[model samples]
Target: MELQLQIKMNPKLYLRDPEQSPLGRNIIQHSILMIQKIGFEDFTFKKLAVEVGTTEASIYRYFENKHKLLTYVIAWFWTWLEYQLLYHTNNVKSPKEKIQVVIRLLAFQLPDQFTFSHIDRNRLYEIAITEGSKSYLTKHVTQDNKDHFFKPYKDLCARIAEIFREYNPSYKYPRSLSSTLLEMAHYQFFFKKNLPGLTDFANAKDDAGVVQFLQHLVFSALKKGS
Candidate 1:
């Protein structure tokens, strides 16, 4: 699979840009693995340094702390997801078909492709599905937003909302619906696996069933305005 994807994130998220050096890039690559292997709360720079064969001070040079690092990784995922949405929907002609494609993209399992040789996107997606909320739901989130840390996520929502507008011109809650679609995709999948009673997907492995439920929820709401 040939996937050429490039995402530019905010400079303030990192102390030194990871893209600038191999060691810096390695910090990001290994951090993703560590965070996935050990949940974000338990992950530490000391452990990551050992895993990457570097000192904790070196890791701090790239990120002020682990939370900032988490934000950077999650931001990268959102930006890449927006790229995927834009790529798949570009040639789609009909508004309904375009919206359907967006739903599928939001709900589908991530592909295993070496789009970026350094980052393992499959693991990153798993992190997003599980630990994404922690990246933003913190006391410093307001400060992070002041630095424009959440821009990529907001951009992704705005793009999807635009598609909602195209599908129904007068839809007042396009942005709300767009964000809900994205969150539901993550939350429902999380629920299906860990807290089965919270979601309707009976089988935890039923990805297709989850997508079908999302389609029903999205289109049913959209069609109400038609």
Candidate 2:
């Protein structure tokens, strides 16, 4: 039997949970592709409807608007990522080594060992690195934050922060550093790809350099009292 993973999502982000029905699944599956191809600015229900072979109303039945839909998918990614971080680190004994695993998970795609069933993990990752911030960087962010739209992201950071504490309980900025590591992973990769001039890996265009840089920064910070 092929076991699949299901990440529970925030209900406020959607009118109906898309995981419950086929049309809802289609909406999510195609939205990632369309968003990756055309981006959030150009993506719309009408276009997504055409892509998914459904009406705009059908898509709206699951999501309140494109922004909420985007949040839904991005939150899904963070939740799944948290699972990946924990699952991969569960047996590891060393806190530093566990965090190293977390960095690698954030930096690279895994060989597809299990079927995800509905969503394309690559498309979703691309959309996340590119459009993930748009989900929260809005005028309504304060209200959205109050409603816990960003919980999965915060949860992921919190998990990392806990690990950081295990490595160095005296570290006062664990949460800040945890969130910084998460954002740095995406920004460095983005720089490596498009804005190469902004990154040191312009010549090599290597994910390994990003991993090394992150390792240096993380371990350097956790090096007890500098």
Candidate 3:
């Protein structure tokens, strides 16, 4: 008689279950839709439940409260973004090109239907602006939670920093420089378009213009050797 051994795979390595419940997913999506329509400040749990065709109590079963729901939505966005970045940058060689790809991707050139609408885009920008200090959604956010959102961004910045350091060994502010570049890249589109006259540079009319402007600004700021 011959005996065969059966191997049990780790669920996380194979088909791991979602940390959130179905109701949780519904609440997150509904809240995001409502925020897109009415903005986060105006959105409420009651409204989301009604929109999702579920009771408010059902939503609470998954999320402890509105803050948790918002956190979930924000986490979902980062997770979605990480997947997109990884997919787009998988074959791109050279850290410089990777940095360029990330800049272009973040500068609103990526094909995201959810982010294309002006209303949706504005609402998201509002959330980012307020969530750091004003919004209750971030009340429970600890350093670890913040790091979760920053992981993808940090990874991209690290890659760019690596290239910068390789070219200019004296570069002392890799993290700061890369972060500033990211902010400048994003602000060129989000802030410039929404809050015109706030800066010297006029709002860009086209996505390509924003990308080109950011590319030139970042490359021009680099040290002569770098």
Candidate 4:
């Protein structure tokens, strides 16, 4: 894959800081690659250290445990996603156009965004669908701590909400329909596509069809007299 080629040819391409010691970043990068190779359930610090030319102790300095590393990976994914959204949405005047661009960017980026091995992807999908529900209920019903995994998405939704309010000030809603639309767009990707067996929407490829479907759904829902 192009992503694997890029990683293999230039490991530092993924690094944000050239000055900082490459040890930690390199270790994390290798760990991610390991997760892609082997299912996360089978991934271990020992295995990662062996594969990445490091010790488990060295890896511990960067991450306390595998779960922490996983959280960091998820957080990094959101940060990258937010950067892409901002980069693409700049100078876009209409909220509708911005929304369309967001959907298109998401669809185009999915193959590159989650470039894991097929087995690992399926395993991660299971976790996202099952554990995600438990985590959602736990956060809402007990702790009230928001998951960092959603930081980028929350920021994007807030921006969309602001645009919606700007366009329709008198509309009565807690948040703009734009925000809801963004959520549904992501839902269609992660839930509908990844967890198709659990969802009713079938044969939905990440293509222009999905983009138009989302755009029409949002536009119709937010129509002047809906």
Local distance difference test scores for all models: 0.86, 0.88, 0.55, 0.54
List candidate 2 segments past 4 Å from native: 109-114
* Number of backbone collisions per candidate: 0, 0, 0, 0
Local accuracy of candidate 1 as per-residue lDDT tens digits, 117-141: 8898878987998888898899988
Q: What is the lDDT of residue 69 in candidate 4?
A: 62
TM-score for candidate 4, residues paired by index = 0.64
Give the distance in Å from residue 86's predicted Cα in candidate 3 to where it truly belongs. 2.7
lDDT of 2: 0.88
What is the Å distance of residue 92 in model 1 from its true position? 0.5
The sequence of per-residue lDDT tens digits that candidate 2 reaches over residues 1-226 is 3346777888899999889999999999999999999999999999999988889988888898999999999999998888778777879999988889878988864443345777998889988899999998999999999999999999999999999999999988999999999999899888888898999998884588889999999999988874
TM-score of each: 0.94, 0.95, 0.67, 0.64
lDDT by residue (112-203, candidate 4, tens digit) is: 44342312333333333323333234334322233343454456667666655655555565265655665565576665656777544557
Candidate 4 weakest ten by summed lDDT: 5-14
Where model 4 places Cα greater than 4 Å from the true spot, the runs are: 1-19, 109-150, 171-183, 190-206
Best by lDDT: 2
User: After superposing candidate 1, which stretches have Cα over 4 Å from the reference?
Assistant: 109-114, 224-226
